[model samples]
Structures are given as C-alpha cells and as structure tokens.
Target: MLRRIVTFVIAVLILGALAWALWPRPLAVETVAIGKRDITVTVEEEGKARIREVYTVSSPIAGQTLRIDRHAGDAVAKGEAVVSIRPVAPGLLDARLRRAAEAAAASARAGVDLAAADVKQAEAQLTYLRTELSRAERLASQGTISESALDKARLAVDTGAANLDSTKASLSVRERELERAEAALIETAVSDSTCCTDLKSPVSGRILRVLAESEQVVQAGTPLLTIGNPADIEVAADILSHDVTEIRPGSAAVIGNWGGPPLAARVRRIEPSAITKTSALGIEEQRVPVILELASPPPQGLGDGFRVVVSITVWQGHDVLAVPVAALFRQGDAWSVYRNVNGVAKRQDVTLGRRNNDDAEVLSGLTEGDSVVLHPSDDIQDGTSIASTSGAQ
Candidate 1:
C-alpha cells in the first residue's frame, strides 16, 4: 500500500506541473512610452465671420420717400444722395371741413377789413392832430393862447401818430391770418417746394440692405437702409462661459472651415456678461460672445455671417513630459495608471497637472522614458504580468 500511494502522488505532481505550464494567460497589452512633446491646449467651436461695424440710415424728416435707386451690394460714397424725400401732400378736406374753412376765411377777411377801417380813421385823426399842433405853436408864439395849452395840444398830436402806426401793424397781421385760412380751402397741396430733400450717406460703404424698397410715406427717424464695409470683418464666436474664462483679449487663435485656407487670428473682445442658451442636447448653458480679429486680411469670398471654426489657444507647453490620457483611470479620489516594469504591470497613483483630450501633464509618480499600458482591463492588477503589444513612443 505504501509503494502504490508514492507512485500515485508522483503522477499527480507531474499532471499538476503540466497543467500549470499549458494554461492560457493574458499578458499582451498595448502600451506607450512617455516622452517630451510640445502640446497646445485649445477650445475649439463653430463661429461666424461678420462685419465689424454696421451703419443704419434713417429718415431725417416726415415725408414721402422716393423709391430706392440702389440695390444691395452696391457701392456708395460719402455725401452721395442715397434717398430722396419729397414733401408729404396735404390731406383732402371733407365737405364739413370745407365749409368751416370758408367760414374762417370770411371771418379773417372781415377782421382785415375792420382793421383797415381803423387804420384809415387813425390816419385821418393824425392829420387833424398835426394841423392842430401847428396852430397851437403859432398861437403860443403870437401870445394868443397860454403856453400850457399849446403844450397839451402838441402831446395829443404825438399820441395820435403812435396810434396810426399801431393800427397799420394790426392790419398786416389780419391780412396774414386771411391768407392762412384761404389756403386750408384748397383740395390738395404740398409743402413749399416741388424739389426733394436728398438724404446722403454719412460714410462710404456698400449697401447691405434696403429697409424701404418702394416709394412710401415715412416718418422721421424711420430706418431706410443698412450699410457696412465688407473688407472690415471679424469673427464672432459664442463660447461657453466656463471656457471663455481662460480666453482673454489678445490671445492667439486660428479660423478654419471658411472654404479656404485657415487664417490666423487673435481675440479682440470678450463680452462683459453671459446669456442663457439652449444647447443641441437640450441642456441650458451660459454663453458669452467672443470677438476675434484677423491677423491678416480676410480671404476672398469670406464675408459677413459666413460660417467658420475657431480654435483659440488657451494653454501651451514646450518639452512637456506627458502620459497617454487613455492609460489613466480613477482610483477612489486619485488617478491611477499601470506602468510597465520589465514586462510586469505595477499600479501607481498619479498626481496630474494640466490635461487635454489626448495627453496629460505629468506632475508626479512618473519618469521620462517610462511605458504605461493603455486601456487597461479589469483583469489588470497591482502586479499583473504583461507584454508589449504594438505601440512605442
């Protein structure tokens, strides 16, 4: 029985050794070597090209504006007549109004007649007063009348002359009132001139739009057209509030997707406030307008409201030691990655610095030339054995 038991135990040991050697093991894993590279972090989003300044022309007075002689995209010069406005015609009077106007005109004529009669009476009285004054002076010199009486006569003559002048001025006022009342009786009429008032462009630019296309009566301050210079253009981007905090005026940027070569640009302005916008995923976000100016002249065919893509540089580094972002995994409160150590995987907790979509800045727990396994699986552990799959640095 002892000999049989020893023989069976030796056979069992051989079978166990064979099974361990032939068992399949997971050792092949893709990894990348850590190295120094130049990295630039940017916030990219869709944007549009637009004119820097837009000018709106409005009517200066209430009148009938003539039909616009210019079309959109037409060039215009300063002090050029862009719009012509004629005086608005007077409205037609109804039968009742016509009678009232006639009555008023008759009353004004009667007033003028009465004033003219008063003037004639005053003139005659002034003539009589002058003759009396001459008689008084002669009597005073000949000693036929008292000097005090002659002085009173002379004062009456002076007062009569002043009354005559006042009467003539009253007649003139009544005559103007009659003329105004008669004008109201006319069936249709226009303000003073047959000529039109030409509204000129204040600045030289192309016509962007014609708000008023046909002849129409417009009030003062009504917008007639829009003008802007196409050559003076800029890019506008509505960026997320969180992303815009890192972008300041004068930051470098690149504009693309404009149907031409990418253009270099720089941030010129960031709006002071943010507005609520609904995203494509139905999420509400705060968006801020960021204006970027082209570093060079805009490419041909790039005009206002053209769609483009803007990549604004936020942070950049030279000679940065970075680890593949795919290799990073969350471990409780810290980040962890599996570094390759002589075909063995050793897990290490890492403290990271600035990170992007593809790589992260290494701040601790790593060294240059170290290789880390990418997309580590659940089977990977603190001391998992692994072999290089394909990728290098």
Candidate 2:
C-alpha cells in the first residue's frame, strides 16, 4: 500500500510540470504612450534657391565687343562699365562707289555753303523789315500813307524772313548728308583704339554668368552676361499639382539639408500654371512651381541654384493629443490601435485628425498616458498577453 501511494504522487508532479511548460506567455512588442505635444503637418519636397530677379546684360548696338575683363561671381556697382565695344569700320568701297561718295560729299558741302548764304540773306531781310516797320509806323502817325499800304509792307517783310528760314533748314539737312557721304568714302581701318562704347551695369550685383568672354562682333540685343543680387535669393519648389491645393501664400516653411542649419522661409506665391515634366523614374507628372522667400539671410554657401529640402507647414496645433503613426492600423472601416491594458493587448478604435510623416493627432478613444503597441503584428489579438519593450506591461 505504501509503494502505490508514492507512484500516485510522482504522476501528479509530472502532470503539473507539463501543464506549466505548455502555458501561453506574453509577446514582447514596442509601445508608446499617448502624449500631449505640438504636432505640425508638413509637406516635404526638394527645391532650389534662385535670385528673385535675374538681369541679362545685352549689347545695345552692333559693334566689336572687346575681351571681357571681369569673370563670373565678380561684384559690380550700378552704372559701372561691364563691357566695352568699338564701332566697326565701314567696308572698303570700289572705284565707282568712291566716286559716288565724293560727289555726294561735294554736294553736301555746297548745300552747307548755300545754307550759310541763306542765313545771311535772312538776317539782312529781317533787318530791312525792321527798318520798313519803323518807317510805316512813322507814315501812319503822320497820315502820309494809307493804313493798308503800311500793313502790306509789313506782310512782305514777314514773307521774306520765312523764305530765308526755310532755306536755312534745307542747308542744315544738306550738311548732314555731306557728312554721311564723306564717312562712306573713307575706308575703316581696324586698330586697337581706346575709343569705345562702355556698357554699364543696370544694378549693383554680382555677375551670375559671362555669356561672351572673348573678343567678337556682336549684334545689337545679343546677350553678353547675367547679373543678380545674391542677397535677394528665393526658393522654388516643384510640387505635384494635386498637392498645390493645400498650400497658400504666406505659409510658413523650413529649408534644410543644404549643408547647414535649417533656414526659415515663407511661401511668397504659387504659379498660376502647371508645367509637365518627366520625373527621374520615367514617369510623367504635372508640377506647379511655388516661390518661397527666406525670412533671414541664407547661411553661408547658399546661393543661386543651390539644392535644398523644404518642409512646408500645412497644418499645426499646440498641446494636442497625439500618438506615433506606427501604432495605428486599419481595423475594418475605422482606424484602431492595440492598446496595452495591464498585461494584455486591447483593440481600441481611435479617430485620427491631421497627420504628418511620423505622428498623428488623436481625436477620440485614446487619452494621455495610455500605452499602445507600435506596429502590432498580425498574430496579436484582443485580450492577448503582451509586454512592452519600453517597460510598459
């Protein structure tokens, strides 16, 4: 009877050990507690800095532009000469052309001489008119001549003076023609002459580019260089057309990842039109250009065409109830999270508001200090035993 009782005790002990070994254990997971903090919703995109206004310097007239002495990035003052050009000499004329030019010059000289003679004649006529007017006044006062006769004399003098003035104008025109004829006859000789037309800078700024650096003949309106103020820099970000609706003028922004600390900026304008471009992934996209003005001077090394990352603040709230986005997942039609209650996982339905890349604003269901499982696994179910890696049971 004693041996049978000892066997029953050993069998009961083995059964209890088996049951303990097979019992379900708590699954380890990462969790975060609901907290109150400032949540900012931002649209992140890459962009570039550019001058607010780029002025292109162009040749004002056709001439031989001299070699440019200044290079790109050189500072220039307003009204300072940036380029120098000399008028090209006229092409060589043949014998017949030379004779024609000489004749034209002679004719012009004769016209000038005639003009001088006409001026003298006009002066003499004016003087005679003055004398005649004086005589007429005296006659009218003494009643020695009819009033109409005196008036007729005055009119004759005025007509003579007008004729003389007309002749003088014709002579001046002829003199200009003579000069043109003489210039045509003279052959232009190319030489290193100091006389040149200097092109001045329109604004005080740095040279952005040197379009023409070598000596060459340029026509009027040919672009020579570009200039812009480095301090007046702005950012241009290309955003998808769909995302443009959320942005507005005067929106706050942060410019970063440009080799220095982030800079504060604001949206100045949104282009009214959309442009089509092929993305690097070989996809066609419609993008709209948004202009951003920096709130302060850009950090050193930031200049025109410098690449940067921009985060535009679309929405923000202070001291709002929020949670890590990883904790939230779709449960049926509403958003839900695996809330840790004591040592078990409980499925809690949550209403979400504005969300950024990392955090989401919690509207209902979850309260401050509540722990929720981050990236809950498929195997985790309501009422499942769980433990948080962050010490939350």
User: Over the stretch 1-393, how does candidate 1's per-residue lDDT look in tens digits?
Assistant: 999999999999999999999986758899988888877889999999998899999998889988998999999998899999997876799889989999999999999999999999999999999999999899889999998999899899989989999999999999999999998887777755676999888888899999998999999999999889888999999999999999989999999999999899999999999989899999999999999999998877898889999999999988988888899999999999998998899998988887788889988999998889999999899888888775756
User: Mind giving the per-residue lDDT tens digits that candidate 2 earns over 1-393?
Assistant: 899999999999999999899988899888877799898999888999999999999998888999998999999999999999987765789899888888988988888888889888888888898799889989999999999989888898889889888988888888888889888777867677546999999999999999999999998999999999999999999998988899999999999998999999999999999999899999999999999999998676899999999899989989999888888899899999998899899999999999997889989999999999998999899999997777322
TM-score of 1: 0.74
| lDDT top scorer | 1
RMSD of each: 5.1, 6.8
Q: Each candidate's TM vs. the true structure? A: 0.74, 0.71
Lowest summed lDDT across 10 adjacent residues in model 2 is found at 186-195
Return the lDDT, model 1, position 244.
Answer: 97
